[model samples]
Target: MLDQDTPHAAMPGLEIPESVAAALSGWVQQVAEQTAGPVRAALEQLESEAAELRDTGAELEAARDQALAASSEHQAEIERLTVELRDARKLATEALVSKAKDQLAIDGKDRQLADLRTQLERNVAAQGSESDARLAAEMELVGATTARDNFEAEVRTLRGQLDKSYAERSALRAELETLRGKK
Candidate 1:
């Protein structure tokens, strides 16, 4: 029991009534007993929630790592495919150029063949003209041959006349010689 007559120990900046202090002490003890069970239960619930949060954080980190790895692999694949596509495009361009060159060569050959055909036609026409000239010359030669045959027959007749005259003159000379001898 506290002595009322003695100086009571006072908290700094607080006045206490005897009856109120006794009632406050009783209230503090009653509240401590009443709240102990619920407080322990609330602390346990908080601890469980914290543990679950830690586990969820670890799982989230693993998921993030897996996603990053998949993304990196996908990027690598995209790069490889891009290179392949570039090579294919290059090959296609070369093939197109080659085909164009081949087509140009074929066109050039066709033009040459056309020119040759034109030259051949001109040559054939020239040959035909030569053949016509030869045929005309042959006809002229045949007419000349007939004229030559007629001229040769006339020359033979003239030679026969000369031979007859020569024989008459020889007979006259012989008669003159016989008369002289008789005289």
Candidate 2:
């Protein structure tokens, strides 16, 4: 080990001339400068890549937020559609019930028409056998004819009612179909 205060005797018996020392120092500096340029460029490129990654992360976060908001809106729309569908189904059911009631009434009217026809036929057959009963039979026939005409008119009115009910039912069915198609 050499004394800290001594310069020329720093290393024993090792003398370096000023000119050769200066040349070695210059070569070391040149080598350091060359290597530092590539190192600084690599550091700058790394920093640029890191900044890009941060931007990508932020964009991904924003996309996730938008998707969540869209999903929430779609869920709300689905709930609203479900309520509308239920209402349409209820209306369809009520229309079907009304149609059934109208059908029953028409059936009753048909039965009444059949009974009136049978009675008229029996009255006509009775009038053919006896002269004394013939006059009474003609009066009975007239009354039966009037009753038949009234019943026929009532049948026509009931048929009109049934037709109106059918129309209403058709309208309800069409509305239901429209609602379903929206889904």
Candidate 3:
């Protein structure tokens, strides 16, 4: 047993021989020296991996934010196009109604001119008035046909635009879904 004066005898009843303690200390020192380099290298590799993970996280966050912004813009554009398409459809309906009215007027005028032509077959003065009526009806019909064609073309263009808007919105939704899936 070691006496109180021994350096390793601080704990009572646990005294060790000087030579045995010295050998144990030496062994511990040797083991520490042997493992220090590998332990430090492992710690350094772990720190590097953690740093890389943090950088990747930041980049992923930025990309997600950008995708969200783009999705917002696409939704707004789709809504605006929807409103414009609705308005164009209303205008096209009015144009169709106007065209139908013009057609009815033209049919009535055609019938009246036919009657006049038949009666004027024997009167030269009446024949002149009949030609004038026919020319006026032709001009009116031409104007109405041109207006109807223009409105039909506009409707077709609006439909095409609406289809494009739907497609763009669908693409955006798919992108958003992909982003969410990644998360």
Candidate 4:
């Protein structure tokens, strides 16, 4: 019986059967498999070649895994940057809209201020004309009052001259009557 750790053909000083050795030799010659005069030599060469091929396959698998990891990392970074860019654009648009609304409100307030100023100026102008008319009416009233006072003074002086003329005429008539009584 062959142990799991030791092959039967690898034991030193062990003799193989004549029929098994003849059959192995004939198969090696038929297949043209090269060996170091022992059937184990060909098997060792085949195992070395298989090990080298497994090492190459392992190296290729590791490279493929690394490439996939790098690609995934790049994709994650791109997605994060895309989300950040979208947020920035949305904030900028909102800021612009708010600024536009504020500007329009300011423009409306400015127009209202201009209209108020114009209305105040028109009211002042109308008041200026009313004040001028009031002053002219007062000046005419003063002129008429002065003329009436001068007319009253002239009428009083004329009545005093008429009374003095009547007294002079009565004295002259009495002197003539006395002269006639003396004759």
Candidate 5:
């Protein structure tokens, strides 16, 4: 038991005895241990949860980095494919232009062939007209030659008849003169 009139019980100039101070310190330590046990367990559980959360965050960050890398690779591939597609379009356009030019050349050739065919047909027709004209002229020449040869033969026959008549006349005259002299 403590004396109530002790200086330690007074508000000022208080001094505690060594035995009671030690007993009070021991009781305070026991009460602190008893009250802090559940708090410590809870703090440990929170710290462990925080460590797990940090690990999960690191994993998420790594996953995000991998996703970003994959996205960058996909973007580069898309760009490359776009360039290839543009080149392909350019090639296709060039091919189309070349084909159009070739078609134009072929059309020109076809026109030239058509013109040549027309000229050949005209030449053949002109030659046929010339051949017909030449054949007609040759027939006229042959008719004229046949008429000249018939006229020459008729003149020769008339000359031969005239000679025969003259010979007969001369023989008669001689006979008449001889007869008269004899008589």
Candidate 6:
């Protein structure tokens, strides 16, 4: 009898003649060949799936990069717009301040003209049609009146300019507000 611990006795309870052993060995080889076909098919399918996953990962990475670039571009545009808006606001404020100063100057001129007219009236009342001095005083009054009229005309022109500047400033503010609302 063969030693039970030998490699040939590893299949327990299998007593085979030499011819039977040869036939069984051929059957095992056929089974192994059949199993190998399915195993190779399964390995090929797994490799195809892995390749698809890699391609998909690459596509996803490309999409992520595109999204990041677009976001950066958008942020840059926003920064540019913000700078332009600040500049516009600064210009509008300067214009308003300039207009206010012009209006104040016109008011001062108007006050000066009023004081001159009052002084002339007092002089006329004090020297009631006396002589050549009175005539000279009347002439002076006429010249002062002309000067006052010129000053008033200048004031009117300044007021018109102020009004135009204010209108322009208002329009700019409205546009700024609209831009801010879009954000």
Winning model by lDDT = 3
Clashing pairs in 5: none
Alpha-carbon RMSD, each predicted model: 54.4, 16.7, 7.3, 55.5, 54.4, 14.6
lDDT per residue, candidate 6, 5-99, as tens digits? 87673556767899999999999999999999999999999999999978876766665566556556555655665565555555555555654
Writing each residue's lDDT as its tens digit, candidate 1 over 1-183 gives 988898988768867998999999999999998999899999999999999978876766665566556556555655665565555555555655654565565466556556656675877765555455445555555555554555555445544544554454455445545434443
- Top candidate (TM-score): 3
The stretch of ten residues in a row with the least summed lDDT in candidate 2 is 126-135
lDDT of 1: 0.61
lDDT of 4 by residue, 16-80 (tens): 89999999999989676555446787788999999997887676566556655555655565566
Full candidate order by lDDT, most accurate first? 3, 5, 1, 6, 2, 4
1 against 3, candidate with superior TM-score: 3
**Model 2 global lDDT (CA atoms, 0 to 1):** 0.61
lDDT of each: 0.61, 0.61, 0.81, 0.57, 0.62, 0.61
Clashes of each: 0, 0, 0, 0, 0, 0
TM-score attained by model 5: 0.50
> RMSD, model 4, all Cα superposed?
55.5
Residue pairs with backbone overlap in model 2: none
Q: State the RMSD for candidate 2.
A: 16.7
Which segments of candidate 5 are over 4 A away from where they belong?
A: 1-31, 123-183
Model 5 residue 46 CA deviation in Å: 0.9
Compute the lDDT of residue 45 as modeled in candidate 1: 100
- In candidate 1 the C-alpha lDDT for residue 2 amounts to 80
